[model samples]
Target: MASDSLHSTVHQQPSPNLTSFPIILKFEEVVYKVKPDHRGLCRGRSSWSSTEKTILNGITGMVFPGSIKRRTGFVAQDDVLYPHLTVSETLIFTALLRLPNSLTNNDKIAHAERVITELGLTRCRNSIVGGALIRGISGGEKKRVSIGQEMLINPSLLLLDEPTSGLDSTTAQRILTTIKGVARGGRTVVTTIHQPSSRLYHMFDKVVVLSEGRCIYNGPASAAMEYFSSIGFSTSITLNPADFLLDLANGIAPDPEHASEQSEGLEQERKLTREALISAYDKNIAPKLKLEISNSRMDIYSFNKHASSRNDPTKAEQWCTSWWYQFKVLLQRGLKERRYEAFNRLRIFQVISVAFLGGLLWWHTPESHIQDRVALLFFFSVFWGFYPLYNAVFTFPQERRMLIKERSSGMYRLSSYFMARTIGDLPLELALPTAFVFIIYWMGGLKPHPVTFILSLLVVLYSVLVSQSLGLAFGAILMEIKQATTLASVTTLVFLIAGGYYVQQIPPFIAWLKYLSYSYYCYKLLLGVQYDEEDYYECSNGVLCRVEDFGPIKSMGLNQLWVDVLMMALMLVGYRLVAYLALRRVR
Candidate 1:
């Protein structure tokens, strides 16, 4: 078989610098299990019960780092890059947020560029690392970028979970080759692979095969087939070495053509079980492997102690960068990432169309038409009320995975990230609302005084902030899009109904509920801005009636304008505080 010849010719040797700094990762008799919920009839008993399921039973192995320090890097199966960011921007941002503050920004950027070149991503470095919806880099290029993100830290021990899982055979080979180069540079790379091709399998210096939560083989890749063959299981056909090992681990015997000379026991050998293979391994291999591990412990301990005493220049601080630095980097990244969504062409068109339509509907309304003017003001409040709410509701749910991944790596503090998101969204969230109010207030012929216009604008903007904070709170608390959106819909509907414009005299029992709605306060404040206590308009009989005496205005007059502002301010701060606390409790 090709695998046989390749295994004999291929040998992996560590770099000559290995002797200077060795890092040995050793784990012994590791066992892991999980409790599964079984909520059905089991063994003819109609009862619910929980049972322990074993995933790894007494597994033991070690990954030998040739000459490396004590840093570790991990890559998950799914690549979690921002779809809007180019490859160069992605790595540069990661470097800025994660690299030590001792290094200047230019130095960190240069390091990211070096990683780009090393990963062969220069061609696509300027391309966006797109997602399922966005089209940018290819699968291979994205996988390489994921690896480069981890490599920025210069980790001595790299752990990857199924790095080549969804790639083609050729692309998978290239990934493994890159990993091999990393190993050759005196670092240790450990990865989990299933059913690799013959050539790919031969590249590994060591192989650890497991079946049914137990280690079946742990030794040099070149010696695996030989070790299995010694136990009366040799393949007669030319098969991939990985395939042959899988067949044995599955308890399927070799072909009849390669059976033992004893014909009487042929059938028994063909039906070999996992227990028999495990027994053979225990008897023949366990003793020598255990002895080697025991002997190496002392050497590994002494080396680690000596290395810790030296002043290693590459060692990073516990937090890597200061809190303010993290905030600035995260703020810049958030703004760049959300710019498109905030100023989307479709959204801008929709807002402009609504503004023009509202302006034309109530164009040049007169002061005598008090009800018409009040309705226009209330519409303003309602539009801004829900516009920012729906947009802000999706903020945290969409970024849940990315946030968890980055935070797990200790890249930044929750405070820094939260503050950046809050501040970065200010201009984007407030822009369209400001435009809407300016257009409609003048067209609808509300109070012509400059002070009234400015106050009205401020109230509308304040209401927008309060509404957005509520949405953010819902999103952070639930972290599920469907649930958060549904809750937001119900809450906004309730607030709209309780708002003074729709029902000036709410039932006494539900009157207290109006106080809980920011919409009610915003509507009252808008009315106070456009009218005064002594302002009057011609009544139906040509008699003068005080504008504040109008039904909607009378119910909520300018007398409590300051109180309404205070309430709106409290809601703004209170909702955001709730959102922050909810985010802290996540994961």
Candidate 2:
């Protein structure tokens, strides 16, 4: 019926309207299609391993028209967000991703206004999205915003799972009423539901009931009660449809050997009612009707399949290409986001503090060598290992959520997000640390050997890269921010101990740990550079000792520093690889 109307120029005929409501999607074979044999409805008997066997098979009937369209809205449970973003910016971001070139200024503004008004979030249009406002926005309002986001592109079929799952009763009813009103305009909506009250259950245009893996029924929502009555069952006046259906399906597990006469009679009546349902819909179609519906359905579904596969600006077609694009775009965006987050904050603090700290220790000659070395030790400890901890805290959690959400839509590869993040941090890594090192080297006059100073800067740059990648790997291993933070902190703490920061060298007992310390390589290079060029004669107990006897052991040590840099580089590459694997698991 929908297909013929689409190919024609005249008004597409509306489907056969139910005295109640027309079907938007059908599964005549959705629930209760499978008979109980040894395998039963879910297949392969009732065992843990076989539990998921017949999941998709039990769904029976659904009906919807080609012209009907639907969209989804969401309200999260305890939302996390960028509080500074205006409501318009949030919706426009979705628009940019979805409608980009198609949406003009007025079009974007008009669309946003419509959403704000419809969702009743207009009064707070310019207000921040987080903090007290998190609870201020009603569940229904946020749900509508989420739906508006999905609706922007004009979807033909919308599947909303647990749309009102976390809302209060009044809010849940409002959401359902909104969904029904949208459906009345000839849109197709399919949703997974649970624990619906009588009013909530009655609001659905259709229902698809799934038990364990098997679907027991799929048809008009109103017809559900009638179908049960026809099978010699009764619903309570105040009965919840979802609960009643769940309890009934639970009884399907009763053993044939132990079944009472009443149970057997009810089973027989269930079979009869199933037959009656098929006959009434004319779905147990006569030979003639089967051919008619087949031609119409074949034509309709072909277009649906085609339409579904084609890529939109937002709904990417290929995971790799989309990820690559997401990488490029996010790289640019993240670099900017990170510049504000890391550079302006850390760079300011590190550069100013390091210059002043180095200046206070600037006049140190070979006589106070131990004091100078101790100061440098604080520099390495406070700066190198700790910075990664902060980077992990701020960046990883947000990116992890973004990565998970993107994967849910089934586009963008994990490797690409990981790779982009690794590459994107480079510009910031180079800029901020370079600024700090360059400023301190000039201010402190520690090394006139410009090459050594530059090499030291590059070494720190490489270490930052390794740290960022390592943080990402840890985040992937632990999904939640708090858990990931605890692990990242613990792991980093362990690595820092092994780093030669506090202890000059790893203990003999943990001798094997020396091989893994990124701190060892980074410190080795920096300490070698400081010792090499800044020659000193130690006055231990006021006894002066000539150190030039060590010859160009200074220059020789600089050559060995390359080994540390190479080790750091390998770590940079290696940690990113592990991070990619972990992120794939997250997806």
Model 1, C-alpha of 50: deviation from truth (Å):
3.0
Most accurate candidate by TM-score: 1
**Predicted candidate 1 versus true structure: per-residue lDDT over 315-405, tens digit per residue:** 6455778889999999999988876786889988999889989999999998788889989988988888988999899999999988887
Give TM-scores for every candidate, taking all chains together and pairing residue i with residue i. 0.89, 0.67
In model 1, what are the clashing residue pairs, if there are any?
none
- Runs of candidate 1 exceeding 4 Å displacement: 1-23, 37-49, 66-70, 256-272, 312-317
Choose the strongest candidate by lDDT. Answer: 1
